[model samples]
Target: MNTDTARAAILAQIRARQGRPAAQHAMEVADVEVDIGRHVRGPQPALGDRADRIARFTAQAQALQTRVARVASAQDVPAAVAAYLHEQALPLNGVAWDTLAAHPWAEAGLTLEYRPPRDEDKLGLTGCFCAVAETGSLVLASSPATPSSTHLLPETHIAIVPASRIVPALEDAYALLRAELGELPRALSTVSGPSRTGDIEQTIVLGAHGPYRVHVVIVDAD
Candidate 1:
């Protein structure tokens, strides 16, 4: 089932448990919709001018051990990604979102499979729906073309984010989603950095659950 259908079913079950009949449940749903339409927002931090958003996001991402790179445009993404992989001595073969299949990846000497990553694949590349400058998180809305596995299954995850898509905070990212999509995607993922765990001897262990490295390529549209 789709996200909206699943959400509706879950809410309906809750309403049923509350002893509300179908009609009353419909009314409650309507009320919730009305509130959602209002797009109420809470207090937000004072993020500086819009131009500084990239800088703030970069700093926060770096603090989380996520390497960041700046590209002039989408056309430069493949080159930048290639350069990063070479610098880190990583393989160039991996899976990528089908939506980016149009890019000149082959020209850049990169071999990216336009599908989900396999066991042998160590890298995954994807695009973000939006990015939170406050926490330096990449917000990904999953679809058939962009599966969640692309961001999780690989040992290394690389994201291509457009600078214009950066928002001040997590709330702003959600607001933008509500404005653009009436309903949420089946899977919405917010990744701040590579996976790590401090369960062993209180020492942080990278790649405990997911990718060990996360490289972000921020494309400046203008």
Candidate 2:
């Protein structure tokens, strides 16, 4: 069936299951909205101060085998990324999200294409939608400017996160998303570290599916 027909069928099934008349549909939707607005989160452990949050995030990230770095501001992001690439002996060429195209990449002596990463691309840079300090995960939302390929196809992935955007818990990340976007994006990708699996012989191997190396650059939002 066509997209509209499929959607109509799904809605019809849902309405039928609800057993509410057509006249109550509006009221049901309104009630759902109210419940969403009044959503009470479950109890969570206190994460202490902001400094503690940063420390916890760094610790968790490192424990997950992810390298983390801190920069004073956005202007320092290029230099930080460059330094990481140089330290790792990787090429200074890669694809990056358009949101970061305005940065001074040339000043850092790097070549970054502001587009989606191609199959041959080995490095990619992206700005995250938010981060979870509790789990040290970078939350990425796919959009026209920020494609999923930038984080998935590359062998080396570099993410720039604003310190202020780091929430205390994973739930807080979703709350921030809802408050800002009013709706979820087409794709929400969360990367705690480089991809790995031990399904074979119970031996760990990184980059089995995605990037072999995941580096994070935390920029001071202030």
Candidate 3:
């Protein structure tokens, strides 16, 4: 076939598919939240099962948020964090500068200090400004509680997120802040999970540059 004809045929095929209904985008893994008083068993077997599928999947996502855990207030963050570190079996060797919010993170191993970045410390355990339950995103702002480098320099990042901070939807995260926090500052980042990509060969790989293991200890304050 001539070059022009071949190009025309390709364009026609593309246009035909463009008119068709496209598949929905992949759902973000975060943003699962549930009030204390709520109950739903297995899916009810019914004819309109596609809706059932969405419900079932959503329930499972909701369960994950519940399982993630929670803590009372920011002050309790440190204690809960100590438990997490003990469970994870991480040595308290490194000491990277982190934002110390009100949450009580149990820091049994880590010696809390204000230190400059050096070759010794690899772990930059920190807390975020707010948690987005919709995407399981950790929102960090430029403040004394959180430093920008902690997110990047850490080999293993452990973020302590409380349930109260978990908003119902992605947009709700911003709404809560807009009312409570006036005139937000620069550099607001939403981190979903550990840094990962499958660009090379469609094989998923974690820890490209960010933390290899991102264990979000979701604390239930209630």
Taken over the whole model, the C-alpha lDDT of each candidate is 0.91, 0.90, 0.56
lDDT of 2 by residue, 22-117 (tens): 344677889989998886788886898778888888888989898999998899989999999999999999999999999999999999899888
TM-score of candidate 2 relative to the true fold: 0.84
lDDT of 1 by residue, 107-186 (tens): 99998888877888899999999998989899999999999999998999999999999999998898888889867999
lDDT agreement of model 3 with the native: 0.56
- lDDT, model 3, position 88: 74
Question: Tens digits of per-residue lDDT for model 3 on 1-222?
Answer: 999988877766776687832322334212222431133333433323333333332343344332243454555656656666667776654444444533333344455444434545666666667765444567776665556667766666666655555554445566666777775657677776677788889987877867666656555553
Model 2 Cα shift for residue 49 (angstroms): 2.9
Error of 2 at 114 (Å): 0.9
TM-score of each: 0.83, 0.84, 0.58
Candidate 1 similarity to native, TM-score? 0.83
Off by over 4 Å in 1: 1-39
Q: After superposition, how far is residue 134 of candidate 1 from its true place, in Å?
A: 0.6
Q: Comparing 1 and 3 by TM-score, which wins?
A: 1
Tell me the deviation in Å of residue 88 in model 2: 0.6
